[model samples]
Target chain A: MQPTSFENMFKDAFENFEAEVNPQIWVQVQQQIPTTAVTPQASVTFSGVKTLLIAGVTAIAAITAAVVYKSEPKLNTLVESKDNPVDNKVEKTVAPVQSIEKVLPELIKENETQKVQPAPAPASTTVLKLPETTNESSANNDNQASEPLNTVTNQTKIKESEPVVEVINQDDKHENNLSSIQNTEAEKTKETEEIKDFNWGRISNTFTPNADGKNDVFKIHLPDANYFKATILNINGKILHEWEGENGFWDGKDAGGYDLPKGMYVYYIIATDTNGNTHKTKGSISILK
Target chain B: MDEQQLVTNCLKGDKTAQKQFYEMFARKMMGVCLRYSNDLATAEDYLQESFIKVFGKLSQYQFKGSLEGWVKRIVVNVVLDELRKNRILFDSNAEVTDVLQTTDDVVSNMEAKQLLQIIQRLPTGYRTVFNLYAIEGYQHNEIANMLQISESTSKSQYQKAKIQIQKTLKAQTII
Candidate 1:
């Protein structure tokens, strides 16, 4: 039998062993950090017409709430942004939107801005006129943020359409201490403008394709997209499978239904939401079995 | 900053602190991953999965034991999970009482890379058992519990792994 020294020899040799980690692994790890940490996850219920309206409205409301919370002290932006006539329609449809505005006056002093523009008059006709004295003060206060807001506002209006336009219009004028508000609004509007902001939920990085009913398929979450085309490729860049529409998934099998050997595969997705905006994303998925 | 401070910052989702912590443990943990995986790619996958888990569960690390030990435990568990998921860990009731003929000098003489390659070359079941028992310093019962195999199966796998490693060492010496 081997002496006890044999075991010690192995342990001693490896106890402090260090191998060079591939720099790419860290890059992949960075991407897989839960999105919930940066973007607060808000699950809201809605009974609706088509999936388009539901997801669009949900994304606008949910991301609005998320962006509001993200900047914490910028609670005034939500109330001021929601003060418009169109947003009044959103508040009637979304309970969370209604609740979020109620807590604003108690949380911050910026509610004075909302008091200055409480006109329930249709904002659709009021377009482009800065809130009288607000534009200069806000522009002077946050030059950097307002610069981007100026550039993106037109594009956001064209792509996302309706609902968010008036918010941008008012926010552009009321930029005093509103850097985070403009930033969140710009960010949320940009996100929503992309593919109707179809909340793809979380895309799991790994799945077991052994058919045990738990994550047996590597599903790309496309909750409300009207059209989607994806190709699953091997590391060698050979296309293994291709499918269309939101029901598309890679079951760890080739087109012939043969179980692919367990390893990492790349997925490229191009999808069009109901608003006809196309989004393209590339990522890797691991087949556990 | 010190380890405790680093952990606190990482928990706060500080990107710089997270990168710092990853740099501190990644190499040693990569070494651990290499021992359990069959190739560099698989090992890299294991490393990525382990670090993601470590960061995700960093809140649960109660600061009781050595941080290295806690991190290594999570690394090993991640490897075991991948192995189990792949279904390569087979149960064997057959006993292997044959004495390991390889001497300690062989291990000492071999480069750590050579030893690691030899370990990686072993059958998945044998290599896994050897890793858990001889290298990771776990008892056969603990290995069995972790692998979902019986105690006897764990003992036999370890014994067979030792014999296989000894034979490989002997062959290399002769060559």
Candidate 2:
């Protein structure tokens, strides 16, 4: 039987019609298809390692933040002096060492100059409370202080030769036993170099946008920049928001000023330093109530 | 390459052949997925999910029909499965609207995107049935079995969907 004119019109339009599909769909599909094209075993192992690395980085960051929170007065000076150039490096180095020592005591011993007294190790309860206190500040305030610590942790992980693999294994071990394995002084210098190069903007992983004035907006903490441009994208890789200049921020809303649901969003930033060097960084941000 | 060779290479875990196979059908399948979904994001989700299923179940395909037809069915089923999870299609009360006069010339003049937008604005029940019966060429009884709805309901949903589309087209002064 012949189709009606109405049915024929739609079929004619859509039968051979091709709609534009997002390229990100192919990426997600590739990640999921285990048995075909990509080796299932290899993808599984790689993702497993990635998850472990993220967990290890997060644990180190938490421990470091907790320790820094414990040594409140000294770090308080460091946090306040974040406005000054003199104390920025000290604050960055000390925070990371405390956290790294919790996971790798031997590594911290190499940088004993920046080490805080490890006697008052923070309890698990203290570790859980640290993020809350930090979250109380504005997005630029707390993230400016805490975000680099995670970057340092990640950079340190990359510098060590597969030690993250061993770190995971020795996670439950006491700190004293971790100090047995000595890391070369050369590696410490390399880590310092990596940290020095990452002076560009850093963003927080999560922010609360319930309009409490504290962290109501996701801000990129760029100390000095002639040019800055950032684009925020939803999971589908669609651009939701875009901003330029150093003071630009996203208040958990789309370009239309609609509140986006709380979920992980991706941000791509390109900042041109006063020296004409460009810095590019991309990471995920999560919106919370 | 021919279909048999491509399928064989894909089954043997050839990355190039798998990508070629995907590039070959991704557009057409995305069209099918878009018609069944409300937005590009949801359509993309169904498209990716269905392709994953297609690749996984490629071994089960007996080369009994056209590979495109086989893949399209999988894409449609994935969308229906997702809509079923919402469970709003059958449970929501059907709203009544006047059946406005529609001209085939008006719909034909509309760009494919405009037509797609009109289809997307349809209520879930009417949209699903309209896609299955009008676009996918499924009979009402077959759609009833697929959606687990009464055949009469499928017919009425399609009719209501047609009226809704015509109403929207009329409102746009396209007719």
State the lDDT of candidate 1 residue by residue for A1-289, as single tens digits. Answer: 2327777889888988999988977886775553234333321212121232335543344334443432222222222344244243222223333444464434323433433454453333233233333343223323333444533432332332333344534433433323444454344223345534555556778999887899898777677667777778776544578777657688899756788999998876766667544455668999996
DockQ for each candidate? 0.34, 0.32
Q: Quote the lDDT for A281 in model 1.
A: 62
TM-score of 1: 0.50
Report how closely model 1 matches the true complex, as a DockQ value: 0.34
Candidate 2 clashing pairs, residues 3+ apart or interchain: none
DockQ of 2: 0.32
Interface Cα RMSD, each model: 8.1, 8.3
The segments of candidate 2 whose C-alpha lies over 4 angstroms from its true place after superposition are A1-3, A36-289, B91-98
lDDT scores in order = 0.66, 0.66
Candidate 1 accuracy as lDDT: 0.66
